[model samples]
Target: MRWGVLGASAAISRRVMPAIAAGGPTTLAAVAGRPQSAARTTEVAAAYGARAHHDYGALLADPAIEAVYIALPNSEHVGWTLRALDAGKHVLVEKPMALSEADAVRVQEAADAARRTVMEAFMYRFHPQQRRAADLLASGEIGDLRVVRASFAFLMGAAPGDIRLAPGLGGGATWDVGCYAVDAAMLHFGRAPRAVRAVLSRRPGADVDTSGTVLLDFGEGRSAVLDHSMDYGPRSWMELQGTHGSITIRNAWAGADEDGTLTVLGYAGTREESVPAADHYRLQVLALTDAARAGTPAPIPLSDSLRTVRVLEAVFASAADDGAAVPVAEEGTG
Candidate 1:
């Protein structure tokens, strides 16, 4: 698969680009950046044997590019994805695929119309540890899942100008890190929450949330409590409480350091398992390519992305109301 990366984003330059170059049957065919960042784009493209385009349109127009990895900001995801699909390119848009569920659904419609393979890039889901956890749950090792608690946060220091803290551009702790916690919960539960209640705190004078804690109810005693913050020190972990046992995952999102670890506690006793150290970014690209080659559906489907955005919308709504529970509308219900 020939992949072109749109935007010389930090994630692209530091992570996904290198992963694509080093992994699987995919080639880093081209890279584009804003017109002002042409020099940087060229430098990065040169390092990867890819063509450099100062304008994103030029990259989309390139006939040699088979797919596009969109590392644009959260607000730009749906628009660029629609354009890429119209340009006859498969797309891998970064997570929180759109700012709202309506936008995500529109993107899905466009992709279906264009018959392109489009996916939200939740790289962590491709990690072996996540796969192993799924296997365990299916095997009834943890019995029936009852409750989930997840947290993903990191101290941003004094960089007020940082994009995560920017007034607009979808800057906020929830949009930045809370999405990961919610996504992980959905991955385990395999269902969208019926209701969500949340409390979000914004930094002084900032319009966006700086931190938030959300509760998702799936009914029948299945629920999740997810917390995220940008003002807090580095912290990431998830603990799933089930009927027979529990599964705890540290470093649930990136897993960039050590091998992914999950510990299980049950009547038999406590046991820990380690999945091989793997580059989730690389794994994501490989999985996309493999699906393309094998004529299979994407590893993560649009329906799943829609569900995630629905939950996100519910959380935001609940936060706006000071933790008043908000009903989540199932996709297509409205």
Candidate 2:
């Protein structure tokens, strides 16, 4: 698959681009950024042996590019995804595919019309550690899954006017990091939450949330708690508790840096299993390319993206309503 990039975000220049260069069945054909950042975009593109465009449309217009990876701001995801599909290109959009369930549905509709692959880029899901964890839970190693607790937090130390601090850009701890926690819970449980409640800590002069905790009620005596913060020091982990045992993952989100371990504490005895360090970003690109070439279903389907945003919508609504419980909107619900 020949790929083009739609932005010069940190995730793209620092991670995705490198991954695309190192892994294949895919190639970085071209890249584009905001017109004002043409120089930086050119530098990045040149580093990966790709052509650079002054604007996103030009990259999409490149007939050689069969797919586009969008690392644009969260608020821009749906719009760009629609455009990419309309351009006859498959898309691997950055996570939180849309800010609302309604918009996610819109993206799904566009993709259906285009008959193109549109997947949310949740690279962590492709990690060996994540796959191994899912296997263990499915094999009843952890027994009946009961609860999930996950946290992803880090100090921003961002300069003034960083896009992450901009409300109009969909900047917030939830949209940025909390999405990973929520995703982990859903991945383990294999379903969406029935209801959600949250308490958010807002930035003093910004409209975006800086920190928050969200609770997902899955019923059947199952639930999940997710925590995220942009102002806190780095701390990330996930724990799944069940009837007969529990599974714990440290450094759950980015297992790319080093070998990751999953600890199982069950009825018989405690054991720790190791998964070798691997570039999940590279693995994700490979998956996308393979699916696209084979005309197979996307690894991260639109339905899953819509489900996650529905839960997120409920989380934000509950937080805005002073921590009142909010029912996750069913399809077509207002």
lDDT of 2 by residue, 30-60 (tens): 9899999988998999888999998998888
- The Cα error of candidate 2 at residue 27, in Å, is 1.0
Cα lDDT listed for each candidate? 0.87, 0.87
Pairs of colliding residues, candidate 1 = none
What's the distance in Å from true for residue 284, model 1?
0.9
After superposition, the stretches of candidate 2 with alpha carbons farther than 4 Å from their true spots are: 331-334
Worst 10 residues of 2 by lDDT: 325-334
* TM-score for each candidate, following the candidate numbering: 0.97, 0.96
lDDT of 1 by residue, 1-334 (tens): 8999998966679988988788458899999999999899999999999999999989999999988999887778888899999999989889879988889889989988897888889988988888888888888988999999999988876575677776568888988899999988988998898999999998677668899999999899999998999878589888889999998887777554568889999999999997777888888888877776676789899899999988898898998898999998876794
